[model samples]
Target: MTALRFPALAGLLLVALVGISRPQPVAADTPAPAGFAAFVDDYYAALFAWEPNQATYAGIHDFDEKLADLNAPNITHRADVLKKLHERLKTLRAGKLTADEAIDAETLDHAIRAELLELEVVRDWKRNPVVYLGKPAEGIDMLMKRSFAPPADRLKAVIGRLKAAPQLLGAMKTNVENPPKEFTDLGLIVAKGSVSFFRNDLPAWAKDAAGKDKKLFAEFEAANKPVIEAFEAAAKWIETELLPKSKGKYAIGPDAFVKKLETEEMLDVPLDKLLAIGEANLKRDQETFVATAKKIDPKRTPAEVLATLNEDHPKPEDLVGATRGTIERTRKFLVDKKIVTVPSEVRPTIAETPAFMRTGGFASMDTPGAYETKATEAFYYVTPPETEWEARRKVEHMRQFNKTGMDIITIHEAFPGHYLQFLYAKQYPTKVRKLYTCGTNVEGWAHYAEQMIVEEGYGDGDPKVRLAQLNEALLRDCRYIVGIKLHTEGWTVEQGKKFFVEQGYIEPETAFQEARRGSYNPTYLYYTLGKLQIYKLRDDYKKAKGADFRLQTFHDEFVRQGGLPIKLIRKIMLPGDTGPTL
Candidate 1:
C-alpha cells in the first residue's frame, strides 16, 4: 500500500516552505547574503545570555557561573525578543539564501515560534513545578557530568549555580499555581532527588574536587547549605500547598495538541485522523506480536511466551558485563553488514544509572551537546534492579533488560542509534540545525533503527529476536495511541495503562509508569510517529534513486541533515516530492 502524506498544517510552516528552490552552485566570488547567517549568530548570542544553563550544556562556558533569570518579568521580556526575531525571520527571502541556510532558517523560525507557544500559550513555567525543580538540578549535573574544565573551575560554576537555586525555587513557588496532579508528583520526586544530590552525592564529589583549596571549599559549603534547604522546603510546599490544589487537567485539549504537533514537528494531521493512524498501527503490531510469539512456542499463549523471554535476563551481578558485551556485538554487526557508516571507533561508557536519574526506565543514551567539544564522552546508562527491592520486584525490573531485549536496547541507545548520530554533529551545516532538534527526527530515527536492522537480518532470522523487536515496537505503538487518547480524547490514566497491558503486552507496573508519563509528556508518540515518517521518506527516496540506491547512502544522508523535522528533511532530500510523510 502507498503510504499517506500529511500536508503542512500551520501558517508558519507554509511560510517556511515558500520559494523552496534547489541548491545552485555559487562562484567563490559571489556568496549568498549574510543577513540570515548574521541573524542566526546574533540570535544564539542573545539566547545564551538569556538562558545561561542552556549555554553550559552547549559547551559555552562563559555562562557557566549563572542560572537563567526565570522571574516573570524577565520571561516576558525574553518572549518579546523571540516575537521580534520571528517577525524578522519571516522577512528573509528563501530564494536569496543557500539551500542549507534556508532550511536552517525554517528550523530556527519553528524553534522561535515553539518557544513563544510555551511562554505565551502552554505556559509550563507557570503550570508545571517540575520545570523549576528539574532545570536547576540538571544545570549542576551538566557541569559535573564531564570534565569540561579543571575540577576547581567546574566546582566554582556549580557553586555559583547553587547560590542561585533559592531565587529559582522562589520563582517556582510564585509562578506555579494549579498544575496536574501528575506534574506535582513529578516535581516532588525531582525535589527529593535534588535535595539528596545536594546533601549527600554533591559533598562527596566536592571534597575530592576541591582538594586543598580551603577558601573554595568553605565557599562551596556556604552556598550548598541554602540550596539543600530550598529543595527541602520546595518538597514540603508541594505536598502541603500544591498537591491539594493540583486539580488542573493534564490535557492540552484538541486544538492545543494539534498546534503542538505543528509547532514542534511541522506536522498538521487532524487529531481524529492521527488517533486513527495510531490505532491502526497498534492493531498491526499486536497481531504481529501474537504470530511471532507462536513461532517461538505454539503451545504457549503469547503472554506465557514473553514470560519465558524475561527469564533469559542476566542476574543482577552480571548485568553491566552482559550489557557491555551486547554493545560490542551490535557495533560489530553494523560494520560487518555495512548497515551505516560508523565514523568513530570510540565506544560509549556503559555504567549504572546515576542516583538522580533512576526514578524510572531501564536504559538511555546520554550524549554530549553538538557544540560540546572537550567533554565529548557519551554514556549508555542501564539501571540495574535495586538491591533493596524484594526478590519479586527485582525480578520484574530485570525483565526489562532480558538478553534478547537488551540487544534491541543496545542498538537503540548506541550503535547507529543516538551515539552514532552524535558523531556527525560537527558535519551539520548550520548553527541553527546544530542547536534545534525536533523529536520526530531524533527519537524517530533511533526507533526506526530497531526494525530496520532486524529486517536486514541482525538476528539472522531468529524468531526470538523477531519477537523481541515486535515487543519493543508494540510498546511504542501503545505510546502513540495512549498519548493521543489521554490528551485529546479525555481518557483517564487507568484507561491508558489498561491499553498498554492488553494491547502492547506490557506488564502492569511498567504500564502505569508509561501512562503517567503521557500526562506530563504529551507528545511522546513521536517514537512511532517519527519511525513511520522516516520509512515513508526512505520509500520515496528509493523510488527516486531506483538503480543507484544504497541503504548505507540513505542512512548516511538522513543523519547528516541533523535533527530537522522529517518534513523539512523530506523537502531537502527529495526536493520536488509534494507527498505526505506517513
Candidate 2:
C-alpha cells in the first residue's frame, strides 16, 4: 500500500469541485460543525507529521524531510495520542453534522481505530521486521519517482531520509522481537534488495536528479553511505541472528483477523461463513475454467490448453513494449463498448519494474495520491525475466505474459482498472474518503473490470480470453481460501502453495509467491471478496434501475463514490437497503 496523508476538513472544504465529463455532487452543501472540523484538521495534521512518508504520498510536502520515529518512547507516546484522539472523536456530536461530515466522521473513526489496533494490538512493529526494513527505500522511492518538486528540492528530501535510514534500521535491530521465520525471510528480501538499490540503482537516480551540483552529491554520498552500510549490516543480522530463532506466530488469531475485517472493510461475517463463500466462488470458477478450456481445444486438458496459450507470448526483450502496445487498444475497447468512462486521456507510462521491486511483483499500477497536483504521471510496471536466468526459466516466466494473460493483466492494472479508478480521486465526496480507502473496494473494482470487459466482448468472445479471465479469477479465488486457511485453519504455507497449483491452476513460481504473501497479508482475500461484492452491488443496482440502468452510469457512479467499504458504498448507492454484501 502507498503511504498517504490527510488534510483538515475546512482546508478540504475550500477547494472548488473539479469538473469532470459527468460530475456528481455527492457532498452536502452545508459546512461541517466548526469544532468537529477543527478536530479532524488537528488529527490529520498530527497524523501526517508523525508519519512523513505517508505525507509525501498524499501529495503533502511539509513532512518530506522526516522519517517515522520508531523509538519505543515515541511508539508508546503515539498510541497514547491516538487513544486521546479516539476519545475526542467519540465526544463529537455526529447528529448535528452535515451528511458528508457524518460519513467522513465515521471514516475517520474507523481509520483511527484501525491504526490503534495495529499499534496496540497487532503490534507489527515488534513482530514484523519488514515494517522497518521496507520503509527507507519505499519512502525515498516515492520522492524519487514523481517529479513533484525540482530535482534539488527532492534530493534534499532524499538526503534527509537517507540520513534517517540508520535510525530506522537501528529500530529494526533493537525493536523487532521473534517474528515468524516467514517474516524474517520477507524482511531479508527487502533488506538485501535495498542494499543493491542504495548501492547501484539509487546513485544513478541521485546523479541524474542532482545534475551538476557537487555539494548536493557530497550530501547525498554522506547520507547515502550509512544507509547502504546499515542495510547490509541489518540484512546480515536478520540472516544470522533473526532467521535462526524467528519462531513467533504469524497469524493474528481468528478473533483479531475477524476484527480486522470489521474495522478495515466493515465486513462482519463469521469466519466459517466467509470461508464458505470463498470456497463456493472457487468451485464455480473452476467449473467455468474446465468448460472454457473445452471450447478452446477439447482434446487438451485445461492445463494443457493454458500451456498452449503460453506458447504465444512476447520475447523478453519486447515485454515492456508489448505491454505499452495494449494501453490505447484497451482504452479504445472501454470507450467503444461503453464498459466504463475513461475520464482522462492521459495514459500511464509502461515501464520495467524497478530492480528492488522485481522479486515477487509481476505487473502493477502506481498512481499519484488523491491530493496530488504537481506530479500526476502514473506508471504501469511490467517485470521482464532477468538476464542471468537460464533460457528455459526465462521462457517459463514469459509464459505469464502471454498475449491473452497480458491483456487481462492490463485490464486489471491500467485501462478501466486501478489507473481509471484513481482518475476520479478529485471527485471523491469528502476529505476523509480521500485520506483513507477500503482495500476490497479498490482491488474489487480492478478485478471486476477484468471480467466486465471480457463479458462485454473484448476479444470477440474468444474462449481463450474467457479462460484467461477465469485463470486470473481463480488466482484471486485461491488467495481468498489460502489467506483464510493459512491464518485461521492452521494450514502450512506448503499446503497453500499446493492449493494454488492444483486448485487455482497457476504457475508454481507465482503460487509460491502468492502463498508467501498470504502469510503476511492474511486478508489478501480482498481481491475476490471485493469483486464478488461489486458484482452483487451491480446486480442489485441493475434490478433497481431496470430499463433505465446503463452499465457506464453504474461504473461512473461507483468510481465517484470513492474507495469506501462496499458495505458503506451500498448504503450510499442503495439507500435504506440492508442487503448482505455477498
Candidate 3:
C-alpha cells in the first residue's frame, strides 16, 4: 500500500477496488510512509484530550469545557496512550519526511518522553504537596484572566474544574506523603493565596458577568464555597499532618537531573561540566560589574552603586506609569541599534500583576497562546507592593522596580524579549513548534535580549544601566551554579542561599527566595543555560553567514524556528552541522 490520500470517500473506494479491507478502513485510513501528517494530527488530538486545560490556554477551545482527570486511573490511561504513541513514532523513517515534519517528529517525541518522566519518574503529583494547590489555582486563573470567552461560558469550565477539585485534592491525602518541608510550606502559601482568588477576584469578575442565571449562580456558589473551604482544609492538613512528617529532602538527584536535561533540553553535558560553565560566566560578570561600578562612582563598591540605582526608583503611585514609560525608549533603541527586526510596532499593554500572581515575582509578560488569533492582547505585569505591607517594606519592594531596573525589566519582558518572541511564535511554521515550548528557548531568548541590548548601547555607556543588566545576568548565572550543587552535590537550602549572596551579589532576603526557588525548580538554570546557547549559536551563525549575517536577520530567524532546544535549533539554522549546544 503506497499511501491513503485525503477525501475519505475516494481513498476508501480506491482501497476497496484494491481488495484489501480486512484491517478495516479506519486502521487503513493512513498508509505507512505517507501517513506522517495524519499520525501527527492524531497525536495532537490525544495531547489536547489528555491535557484539556493546556488546550484551553493554547486557545484550542475544543477542550475548554474539560479539566484533566487527575484520578490515578486516568493518569495511567494517558501515560499508556503516550507510551503507545512513542512506540509508533519509531516506525516512521526520518529520511522519508519533509524537514518540517521531521523536526515536529523530534519535538513531539521529546515532549512525550518529558511527560512520561514527570509521570512515571519525577512524579511531582505524588511527592509535592504544592501540586494540589498550584494546578487548580492556575486552572481557575486562566479562565478568569482571559476574555477569550465570556464569563458565562468560561464559568461553566470553571465550575467543571471546581466540581472535580474536591476529589482531586482529597486524593492528595493519600497520594502525597513525606514531601519536602519547603513543598508543604509553599503549598500552605499557595492554598492560603487561593482563597482571595475565589472570594475576591472570582466574585468581582462574575459580578457583571453576562447570562447570570440564578441556577448557574447557585451552582457556582455551591461549587465555589465548598472548594474554597476545602482549599483551607488542605492548607491546614499540610501544616498539621504533612509538616511534622515533612522531609527536608527535595533533590531529584544526578541521574534524574541529567535525564531531564537531555530529554527536555537535548543537552548531554554532565552536571559538573554545567557547573564549571556557570562559574566561569559568573566570574566574568562579577568582574565586569565591579569595573562598571567604578565608572559610575569611584568611591562606591558595586553593591553600593547598585543600591544607589535602586534608590532612584519610582514612588508607589507611579509604579505602573513608570513601567509604561520604558516601552518606547527600548523599542527605539532596538530599531536604532539594528539589533533585530521587531516584527511589531505595537507595545504590550501595561497592567498590575494579578493578586494570585504577586506571590512569585516582581514582573513578567503574559501573552496569548501562539494559535490565539483573537483577544490577542499581551500584558507586561508589574507586581505592585501589597497595600497592607508596612511602609518600609513597600519602599523596599519599590526599590526593585527602580527606574533603571524597570528599564531592564521592560527590555526583558517586552521590547525585544518575551513579547517579541511570542509574536514570532505565532508565525512559526509548524504546529508542534508553536505549542511545545522548551524553557531554555522561551526564557533564554528573553534573558539573552537583556544583555544583547546592553551591548548594543541602549544605556548610552551609563555604568548604572550596564550594572543593572549584569545584575540580572549574575542572578541567572548563580541559579545555574546553585541548581546543580543543590540537587547533585548534597547542598542544603542554606548553602544555596550563601552561594547567591556570595556569587550573585544579592541581599539576604532575596537570596533566600532565589535559593528556595532552586529547591523546587532545579531547572531555573535554564535562564543562563539558554542564554549561553544563544550566544554560542549567534557566534556560529555569524561565522556561517559571514558578511551576510545581519544581527537583525539572525534574531528574526532564531525565533522563527520556535522554542526547540538549541541543539535542534542548530540543525535547523546551521543545517547539517552536528555540534554541541555550548
Candidate 4:
C-alpha cells in the first residue's frame, strides 16, 4: 500500500452505466464471434467482483461495501478463476472471430495472462507489504471522495470497508514475509499516512453523514477506530520487524522483466536495445531543452534558465487556481486546432491534492470510470506546498509548478490527456478494453500529449514554454533510464537521484522523490517509451493515411481504442502490420 493515491456533491444524476459497449452482462452460454463481447463482459464482472475497490472506482458500486479478501485462500481462488478463464478464452479461436472481436479476443487473452503472471510469479502481495497497506487506504478514499451515493450510503460502505480493513492487515502479517527494505520503508510511510487519513481526514468527511444519523454515526465512529489502529499497528510492525529482516529483493531480473514487457505490453525488444532507445530519446530532449533555455535568455546558463522557469510559478495560494486556469485554454486549443475530439463537452473539476498523496509530486487525475454511476465527479488534483515547509523547500516544490511547467503538466493531466482519455474510455469497442490498460498506453498518452500539444503550436513559439515542456520530458526521460538501471543494473535510489539531477535537470529534493518512486514503480519508463512508440505509430499512421491524415483524426482514433498498448493499436490502425513499436 502507498500513503497516497478522493468527493462529490450537487450532481443529482446517478449514472448506473454498466458494461461499456454492451448494456447487460454477457450470457455464459452465448456462442463465439458474437459471444466474444459476452466473454469480455463476463471477465470484467468476475474481475471487478474480486477487486471491489476497483469496482467502486469504475462506477460500479454494488461491491462498494466490501473490501477484497486478501487471505491465501481467496487469493488462490481468484488466481484459480483467472487460470480457468485463461483456458476458457483459449477454447474460442481468435481465427474464428470478426475483425473487432479478434482484437478483443487477443486483448482479453493478454489481460488474463498478465494477471496470472502477477499472481503466480510476480506475487508482490507475498513479497511487498505496501500492497497490503495501499489497497485499503485507496479503497476507503474512493468511498469518501466521490458523491455517487448519498453521504449516508457512502459512509455505510466506509464502515463496511473499515470493518474489513483489519483482515487485510492480518493477511499482511501472514502473507508479506520478508520484503525489500525499500518496500518496508515505503509501506511504513503509507501505513503511517493511512493512520493520518483515518484519524483526521476520514472523521471530518464522515461527520456530515454522521450528523444526519446519530446512531449510524456512532456505528461509523465505533468501526473507524479499529481500522485506524490497525493501520498504525501495521506501520509499527513494518518499522520494527519487517525493516530489520527485509531480505526481499526488488528486481524482477532480466528474464522476468523481459517477459513482463512482452506478455503485458506485447513488446519483445532486448533490454539493452530498450535502454539505448531511452538514452537516445533523453539526449534529444536534453539538447532541445538546453537550446530552448539559451533562446529564453542567451546570457544565462541552461541550468540558470531552468531555475528561472521554476521560479516563475504560482504562489502557494494559486496552485489549484493555476491548474484550473489551464483547462479552458487547453480545451479551446484542442478544439480550435482539431487535435482530438473532446469526447464530451465536460471539463474536469480541479481540486487540492489529498493529504496522504501529497508526499509524492503534485498533480494527478482521479477520473470516475466511464460507467461510473453515483460518484460521477472526475477530480484533477494539484498539490500545494505544505504550510510547515521551510522557505527553501517550499521554493523547490513550487518550482515544479512554474508558469510553463503548469502549462505542460496541465496538458499531461487534463485537456487532451488523462481526463480526455477518461472521457473516451467507456465508448471503446470492447468491455475488456475499458477495464484493462497498460501504463505505456495510459501514461504514454499523457506524456505524449504534453509534447504533441507544444508541437501543434500550443507553445506559440515561446522558448520558455518549449523549455518547460522539455524539462517535463527530461524528467520522464530520466525515469525511463532510471527504471531500467535500478531494476536491471542494481543502481541504488541515491544513484538514480544523482542521474535525475545531472541528466534530467530536476532539482535535488524533487529529484530524490522521483528516484524513490522509481524504486517502487519500475515500469514508469513507459511514459517516455510509450511516447516514442506513439510517435512512431503516428508517423506510420500518417504515411498510411497520406492526404487522409488529419492530426485530430489520428488522435480521435488513437484514444477511441481505449488504453490498449500501441502494438494492438497498430493492428487496428495500420492493419496487418507488425513493425517495431519504436
Each model's TM-score, in the order given? 0.92, 0.93, 0.91, 0.92
Best by lDDT: 2
Give the per-residue lDDT digits (tens) of candidate 1, residues 273-351. 8989988988888898899999999999999999899789999888889989998889999899999989888888888
Off by over 4 Å in 4: 1-34, 387-391
Q: Sum up the clashes in candidate 3.
A: 0
> Lowest summed-lDDT stretch of 10 residues in model 3?
7-16
Candidate-wise lDDT, in order: 0.80, 0.81, 0.75, 0.79
How accurate locally is residue 50 in candidate 4, as Cα lDDT from 0 to 100? 77
| Candidate 3 displacement at residue 201 in angstroms | 0.6
Off by over 4 Å in 2: 1-34, 387-393
Error of 2 at 308 (Å): 1.2
Q: What is candidate 3's lDDT per residue for 419-449, written digit by digit as tens?
A: 7776666457665666677767877888999
* Worst lDDT 10-window in candidate 1: 1-10
For model 2, the run of ten residues with the poorest summed lDDT: 3-12
RMSD of each: 6.9, 5.1, 7.5, 3.9
